[model samples]
Target: MMMVQPKLTVVGAGPGDPDLITLKAINVLKEADVVLYDALVNSELLRYVNPNAEQIFVGKRRGCYRYQQEQINELIVERGYSKGHVVRLKGGDPFIFGRGAEEMEYATAKGMDVAVVPGISSSLAVPAYQNIPLTKRGSSESFWVITGTTKQHKLSEDIRLAAKSNATVVILMGMGKLSQIVELFQKEEKNELPVAIIQNGTTKKEKIGIGTVDTIENIVEEQQLSNPAIIILGEVVNHRNEILQVQRNINSKLTKSA
Candidate 1:
């Protein structure tokens, strides 16, 4: 009897770009015997999986029948021990608000080998795609990333100050609490500040809703924007329109030249 090789690789799918996936992650998927992926992951990346590999949807979507964390943990453990190679794919960096750490801890406790591959976080990438630089000398100096749906269900105290400070704020998984989150910033008289809510950032499905902190709640409501979105709040949000206009002008010039 031969001892089976127990290997578990948790890979980040990046921020909605199939091409952003790491070379190591692609190789892991290509060699994996089993791949468990999340809802945010682009399915196109799965094309690299071994033809005989088993692909499972373990995504946890809000208001949907999300696979329980415990169940997912067990699935990873079971599959990892049973298969020669198992890959747990997630959107964004595995350790950044991705629960990848939790999954890794559980599997490691069971004596399984685990490795993590970093991916681009939408919190940072989304704003970049929108041309809203998180930090500019005269604009912003720092940025904060917070999850809107935390156990406390309140913006982190650090983020509360960010609302008042010059730091740009990016909230992930926050669509459902959009109104409340905006109100949190408004309570301190930061309501007049610019903000942008981008859904499906970095993808063709991207949609941007812009308004002041005071008016964003209504704008988002009127737009019916949903989750899996990145909310940017601060002066950086004020630049979105101008940046987009600049991009359009550049495109028009290229078109005319062609």
Candidate 2:
């Protein structure tokens, strides 16, 4: 009998909302024999996994990683070859700073059939949920998404250029570097530029802290915002206030009618 090679599927679980998960991701989870999920992923998503499937927690949290990257890669390859079907469920889009590419590379190197299912990236969804559009007809023509931390745990040089450009800037996993990021803009005389930091966006625990480059770092500190947050910097941040005002007016009219 010819041997059958096991398959590996990396599915993006979307931003924290369970309903945001795509049907394709759910389908793959239901067919999985083993599921390795991240910490940021909503626990509700696990319900989609087959009842007989083995679930593993491999998420990385502040100052603690359940499984190191090297170990995770090896485990995926091992399970993919031995287990009938393996699903690596990640938070947000697997390619959007989710480290899904590394896993895919490792799996293919081991001769395993790998597949990817893209999810809604918090970079775009989080800002939209807060009523902040990444681009506007006259305000911004482009947007740049940047990682807050580099291999050395320092701010990326791209942020400097981003601050100097007219493009909207979105920073992921950058709450810790908030002070430095704000200072970068301050150096470029963008002190009054609007900035908003949203923590746990798209979930029930969501909180948004809005300020300007001059005051945003302090506002985020006072609000106790932390990781798993998205930082948006540009004129687009002001749109949220306009949206809220419009919503308040509508609510007032409805209440009076009632």
* Winning candidate number (TM-score): 2
Top-lDDT candidate index: 2
TM-scores, all models, native as reference? 0.91, 0.96
> lDDT by residue for model 1 over 1-258, one digit each (tens)?
766677788899999978888898898889998999999999999999998988999986766746888999999888877776789999999888999999989989988899988898888888888888888778888888888777676655666666677788888877777767777787878868898999998999998888998888788889888777888988877687887788999999999999
Q: Clashing residue pairs in candidate 2, if any?
A: none
**Every model: Cα RMSD to truth:** 2.4, 1.5
In angstroms, the error of model 1 at 122 is 0.6
User: Local error of candidate 1 at 9, Å?
Assistant: 0.9
lDDT of each: 0.85, 0.92
lDDT (10s digit) by residue, model 2, range 143-172 = 999999997999989999999999999999
State, as a TM-score between 0 and 1, how close model 1 is to the true structure. Answer: 0.91
